[model samples]
Target: MQHLSRRQFAKAAFWLPTLALAGPAWAQTGDDPVEFVESQYNNIYIYKRGTQVSMTFGHNKRLYTESVMDTTDTKALPVEYTKFMTAAVAYTKKQDSILQIGLGGGRTSWYLHVHLPDAAIDVAEIDPVVIDLAKKYFAVKEEKNFAPVAMDGRLFLLRNPAKRYDLICIDAYRGPFVPFHLLTKEFYVKVAEHLTEGGIVAQNVEPSTMVFNAAVATMKSVFRQVDFFPAAGNVVLVAYNDAERLSDAELLKRAEALQAKYAFRYPLTDLVKGRREPSNPVKGQILTDDFAPVETLHAIERKNEKWK
Candidate 1:
């Protein structure tokens, strides 16, 4: 796992929804009236006139409800996402089961449903409002292959211990940032507990941000082998508990095969590069509930460009 700045990551992830909820300070702006809606205990401010959503940070940054559907954007489905999916597809043929932890605008969920028709997808989202908004505004459709589970991902995974998935995607984020509990060693181990043999966990980690280093450290503690794919200022961590190594040559060959099959834009070029020489090659620290301090690691990444 690596860390990246929120601003840099935001730029890289142009398709991700910007979080700028409305607050009392926004009410002071009398002329531009903003409607506020609370979802999952978070305040979401919608501009009464247009598609822009306001931020509570006092800086009025607006994001369109339509951009959420554009999975091609680096933020939504970063190049790393396509690469990880390619690898997962290669590894598990014949429409294996795929589980996604988060469903923001249903970008990855819809893409997987459309592309991997044979694969069964289970999407767990904490906020139904986001899911509903994605459907109303982002044009996210649900089909037989897609199962939307409105529940906390951690609790769901724990409850369904028998459920094993071939590919698991963890993209849970909290208002422009990843929640600290979700990035801990304990949580990752729980993720491992629900995985099938040879299954890979693809985690969307913002390395430049505060949560990046702790996430990497936590992931390392659970999986026997972990690899990174950097794209759009974010790192997608693919962890394998069963195998220590996945041959680079094999991975490249498979990537090429997938590109021909799917015609993906980013495909597997950069993923292959990361495999050769990773940014954080050695294990740094284990991220436990009490001991993890991801913010500090994020600060170090900001100072040292070598992590990239």
Candidate 2:
């Protein structure tokens, strides 16, 4: 795996996908037609290309892929960030209760539900339309232990004060940006409160945006220890309240054990191997509920990058 610089990430997130879409191979053919389009929280589009089905949020004539799944193989995660997202399991030994903040196509939730049959999984998807499409087109289903709810992620945590999860996965995004409320220090405080002791929270962050550093800072404010796993244009941040940090060797050892036990499609060991130190003296202000300028920061960052 290659480590991308901030600028490289921006290019990959913005330009690479756009360029790919312009190519003949990516042009929408009769076989790759849009399956559904709805307007609720955002303008959502679901399309299929051969065996791959994807969910994209449309904004300003641009489409940002929120989730992708292989129709032929529901268990296969076609997105790179998703594969790394599952590596969150390597940080904790318990999988009794898991909470996912975003449901996208429910690929991550479905994958975890299948792999961890005994674990209880709760998913919070803000858009009810996405949940419906996820079930109809992506094979997301409510089973004995798996449940997907349509509600704001923060609200879900606030509503369930007594519920504590052993692992919390945050991959929530609206188009190219994360909901402002989800990026604040206050929200992370709530997230930390709902975690069981020694529990870990894994978040998928777009390193290209200005919010990236601030999001990291905000999580660090709430979590005692933070680690990074950079994959493609995204960096999965795994944070916990534990005082002692887990070393690379220890993480690798744990990943190896979990890999042997579960036989994951994307080897956990490969994901753990990409773990490295985050940027030093973390640059960016700690985001608070009272002052989390997510959209403004993203706009400014995009403008600055465009000229350079």
Candidate with maximal lDDT:
2
Enumerate residue pairs that collide in model 2: none
Error of 1 at 260 (Å): 4.7
In terms of TM-score, which candidate is strongest?
2
lDDT per residue for candidate 2 within 50-164, as digits (tens), equals 5667777766666677777767789987677777789899888788999999998998888989998888999998999889889988998888889999999999999999999
Superposition-based RMSD of candidate 1 using all C-alpha atoms, in angstroms = 6.7
Candidate 1 residue 135 C-alpha distance from true site, Å: 0.9
**Alpha-carbon RMSD of each model:** 6.7, 5.1
| Tens-place lDDT digits, model 1, residues 1-308 | 12122434333333233223334444455434244456853444333212332122111243322112232332244333444434455444334788988776566667767767777888888777766665664456677878888887888898888888888888876645566677788888888887777777888766654356557667877887777666545566778875547777777776667657765444554445554235445446777878767656655653232445
TM-score of candidate 1 to 2 decimals: 0.73
Score residue 188 of candidate 2 by CA lDDT: 95
